[model samples]
Target: MLNFSNNKLNNEGRLRTVLDIGCGVASFGAYLLSSDIIAMSLAPNDVHQNQIQFALERGIPAYVGVLGTKRLPYPSRSFELAHCSRCRIDWLQRDGILLLELDRLLRPGGYFAYSSPEAYAQDEEDLRIWKQMSDLVGRMCWRIAAKRNQTVIWQKPLTNDCYMEREPGVQPPLCRSDDDPDAVWGVSMQACITLYSDYDQGVKGSGLTSWPARLTSPPPRLADFGYSNEMFQKDTELWRRRVESYWDLLSPKIESDTLRNLMDMKANLGSFGAALRRKDVWVMNVVPEDGPNTLKVIYDRGLIGTVHNWCESFSTYPRTYDLLHAWTVFSDIEKKGCSGEDLLLEIDRILRPRGFVIIRDKQAVIDFVKRYLVALHWETVATADSSIESDHDGDDIVLIIQKKLWLTSGSLKDTE
Candidate 1:
């Protein structure tokens, strides 16, 4: 067994709290206590409560529950590290029921270690499990941090559904899957239910613990539930044209005097930037660092795009642009664990006074931006709804917003 004391994989040596499932007699918890680490162990002692008392006597906190049925009695994102040793239940299963609960329990960038002696077995049954496990990790949105002989470790993503591929040629990651060949949307009903159920239980974006209290409806199903490479390829041209036509329609209405510099958030293939080139606007685009390989084609077209991981804070100065164009950017960001409020705040910081924002996105995102705009006192100049919707996606709504320059005492004195 790898030493947990100084393992670099334990969140860069800052491992604090651990959840040890199927903790037989809580021996691991006792050891963790010796190392001054908080060990929250889970075990069953209904027939005989001796093991529970033993763990408590050792100064280790332990809980009683059937792992698969009962929800873990803890807040969301409560553990930094989770471990399971032959926990009876198949941890590598892609069913998404219990695993979704585990995902919710783990903090962003937290670690999960599952140890199985079967992984080292040469038997046919063990071999099949190992292969399925491999396939499961490949389909999951999480990343595999490391693997020992019988133990595999995973890290929870900072943002769910956001791809972070090291190589450019690989396909973008999928959020959820059912392994079903004939299901509509190619995803099983169970998988969709699990994903949304977890989301409702507070498996949400970075810095968020629960869903908005104002939301009365149940959480929606995973928006990109059954995404595939073929689907993306087919829709690429249609999406590109949608963006181009959106800007073409808005070009005449925009105030030419104020539209100088432009920033395109989530600039997939840089189509929106290319669309703005007809005007004299200096366009800069932002894309995820591990975005699709098609981005190379955009670069080949001589468009300006900067690679950025939107999961983290953006690197830019305030009030840097006069115009911002976003097509489905807010929805994508929201799906990947970024709140629209947070993104709009960043947009507000980087936009100049009286600058314009052109957003072509879904109704939810538009509502979020409008709420914040009203709170921030920004002005909305126009709104439009597209008659044509995405082939399989939601309808698009457009909003034109202008940044307001308010007169403060300091700035008023400067003008005087």
Candidate 2:
């Protein structure tokens, strides 16, 4: 089952609320929340009823309702998040309306995420249904995994923003519209029929939401490092754009391009942090870097203050991150629109002496990184920022530096 925790949901002090449609008996998402008020919807079945009752008995706010029913019993923009976990979407005739209704209930900009419905074998019906369901959601997408199962995420555009529907007159179409109510539901009905057909043909399986999981909130910005607000914002965009551009360049080089890029930076850092088994490593992280190409590894500050807040909830299975790495801190490397010796010095602190650092930064940052590293007494192992440059008067710099071994506690500069 999928869960949305404060980490993914946290945004500048905003209180969080979630609605899980096709919310089965176990209430997977509700249990992970720090607060209550999770809305639950389920199909009309004794099994579902017993599940909702169990959740309520355990003090989880739950309800029994059919998906897409007009009587959602909730007001406009009632929640900040609406999630679906292994909803019987493939087998429910009315799930189309349910998806639309979930959109209506979501505040503009609220997340509408669902993780379910693995692609069955290469059966004709399976592929057809897969295309139909995916096309129904806006082209916006994210993955929880790569194989048979996939998680899709989208957002209800804010009140002032418009959706990417077919252009009324001359513009190119960005995506196929699911505005046609009949067309949308028609595909869903067929999927339902297909699943039932399978069952009738002697296939049997329980739902996938039975497993339990927790959504987590990552660490807070600890003591402010030397970075400034202006620099932070600029670096954030720079890293994102650079990483995206790198993905574009690197795609053809790999077989599974998307998977490779995802593993390159942010996703890699996230998975790495989640896999922590050591106490010392648990406290380290690759945090966000505002500038381009800098990785955001590690919490905002030292791991000292964060362990307590994290332990409050995940005491038995606490979060552990030893070192920050990859695209997470790439922003810190690029220097983006920023250029400063002090800021450069801050970046130098993130590394453990003698540790290796891979940075894809702005062309301007190369000289700075070199100067900074030499100043910090680091030994350069290898450095290159796509040595080939375009004829255009612009380029980015890359540097690969490693903390070198020292025979004594004295600085490398002293030896030199």
Best by TM-score: 1
RMSD of each: 19.7, 21.0
Candidate 2 per-residue C-alpha lDDT over 283-358 given as tens digits, one digit per residue, 9 for 90 to 100: 2222222221112112111110011111012111111111223432334423343335544344344344444444
What TM-score do all the candidates reach, one by one? 0.40, 0.34
Candidate 2 segments exceeding 4 Å error: 1-15, 35-47, 90-95, 118-123, 139-149, 169-416
TM-score of 2: 0.34
Which candidate should be chosen as best, given lDDT against the real structure?
A: 1
How does residue 4 of candidate 2 score in lDDT? 41
Scanning candidate 2 in windows of ten residues, the lowest lDDT window is 302-311
- Per-model CA lDDT versus the true structure: 0.58, 0.37
Model 2 gets an lDDT of 0.37
- Regions of candidate 1 where Cα sits further than 4 Å from its true position: 1-253, 388-393, 413-416
